[model samples]
Target: MKKKDSNTIAQNRKAIHDYTILETVEAGMVLQGTEIKSIRNGRINLKDGFATIRNGEAYLHNVHISPYEQGNIFNHDPLRARKLLMKKKQIHSLIGETKNAGITLIPLKIYIKNGFAKVLIGVAKGKKQYDKREDLKRKDINREVERALKNR
Candidate 1:
């Protein structure tokens, strides 16, 4: 199997463990110069980030992109809400999905693709405690099976 590219800047592993992702969409971000510079330096965090569709637009919240060290006066806010660029049809579809109870838009990861910063958003459903436990058990079982096969 091939490994993921180094282009991935940040990932929200907690979001994956806490929510069941039903679908994923890639969206571009409208970032300031310093913000993009910081991202390229690996100074971004997606652990607490989430996406919201408001007034027919998608915005990302709680993602932190630290200010560039040399940016000085031009540095952007570290925790500011950033705009996400998506097609109108995609935004409308996300609006419908998010209106359903327990459904939400979560930022799964950020990566640089073809010189552009992209966010991978997941349409997710909240998982109950038992559901999380069950998922953990299933993962453990899969790992054990893989180990057994490797040793055979």
Candidate 2:
């Protein structure tokens, strides 16, 4: 028996800076052949992408999967909305949290696990200006501490 390794593609670094992530879930993406190829080639971007629970299902929107170089007409649309596979209960809960609690659904990372593409989605709350400032302050403090320790 051999252990399998997970391969990660692009990650949304802006999401962490803009939102406070509460919980994360791994969901499978419904992709076409060319789209899959594009993703495997690291041609995907999740910077402005988000997930939404609509009509009892989750869909990823604004995700850009570049056109596959080899596919002429069969290349999928770069900004097409893709379905995300998750349990029914999870979908319902997410819908409630988004609609009632005012949380957001953010796609954190896209990765290949066991030969299938999986997305790590997070339940997040938008960060306030002060919160972002606090994060920056904390980072600076940590950097100062590390520098002091190195010089000692």
Candidate 3:
């Protein structure tokens, strides 16, 4: 038997700077054929995307998988909500945590693992303005130190 490698399709870069991710989990996506095709072609965007638990199930919103050009009327909607496959208990836990102030369920990235499309979702707390500034300061300091060392 051969081992299959995972390939990343898209990432949500803004999510990292905007939220302090507490935990991450892999979840399966319920996608249509056309949507999957579009994703495979690297036409997906998860920048403004998020996950929500509703009616005992989790759904992904704001994820855009560009319409597959060849499929006329059968092509799925680009920004349509997609269901996330997870255990019921997990869904309940996510709902409870998100009910707390400032906590949220955000999509971190979308990737193909062993030929299956999967989503990496994160439980995160929003960062304050000052927090972002502090992170930027630390990053700059580290860069300057590295440059100084390289020059020596």
Candidate 4:
């Protein structure tokens, strides 16, 4: 039997801290030769990146794929908008959901799956001040309970 390798590269921790993630979707990215090389070298960043529905299709913005050091002028732009490949129905559904006020499409992570680059996109809503405070309080309470259980 052969061991399977895990396929994670980088994650956007800030997205979880600032937004209430409601749903997640895996989508493929269209990449050029140098761009693929850069990603395989772990030269990518998804933090502060997001997706937008434009012309009935989804495009990722602010996701950086660093230039391949060995490549010449053909290297891809680091911060260029990359198109996300998804089914038409799925794109339409996400567009509808994003139409709701205060809802957003955030990039949660970028990883390699089945020899291709895939991005984990999250449908999220921004948290209000009170909601953030309440979440902190809940986390503190849970930590206290766990500490008490461990000492007992």
Q: What lDDT score goes with residue 55 in model 2?
A: 83
Model 1 lDDT at residue 89: 98
Sequence-dependent TM-score of model 1: 0.96
Question: For model 3, how does the per-residue alpha-carbon lDDT over 1-152 read when each residue is reduced to its tens digit?
Answer: 22433588888889999999998989999999788888899899998898988889899999999999787888898999999999888888888888899998999988898888999999999999999999999989999998999999
Q: How much lDDT does candidate 3 score?
A: 0.90
Worst 10 residues of 1 by lDDT: 1-10
Stronger candidate by TM-score (2 vs 3): 2
Model 2, CA-based lDDT = 0.91
Model 2 per-residue lDDT tens digits across residues 38-70: 889999999999998878889999999999999
Local distance difference test values of all predictions, in order = 0.93, 0.91, 0.90, 0.90
Please, what are the lDDT tens digits per residue for candidate 4 over residues 19-132?
999999999998876898898889999887999999988999999889999999888889999999999988988988999999999999888988999998999999988988
Name the runs in model 1 displaced over 4 angstroms: none
Put down candidate 1 lDDT per residue, 17-73, tens digits, no spaces: 999999999999999978988999999999888898889999999999999999878
Off by more than 4 A, model 3: 1-6
Best by lDDT: 1
Distance (Å) between predicted and true CA of 135, model 3? 0.6
Which of 1 and 2 is the better model by TM-score?
A: 1
User: Lowest-scoring 10 consecutive residues by lDDT in candidate 3?
Assistant: 1-10
Query: Total backbone clashes of model 1?
Result: 0
How do these models rank on lDDT, best leading? 1, 2, 4, 3
Q: Itemize residue pairs with steric clashes in candidate 2.
A: none
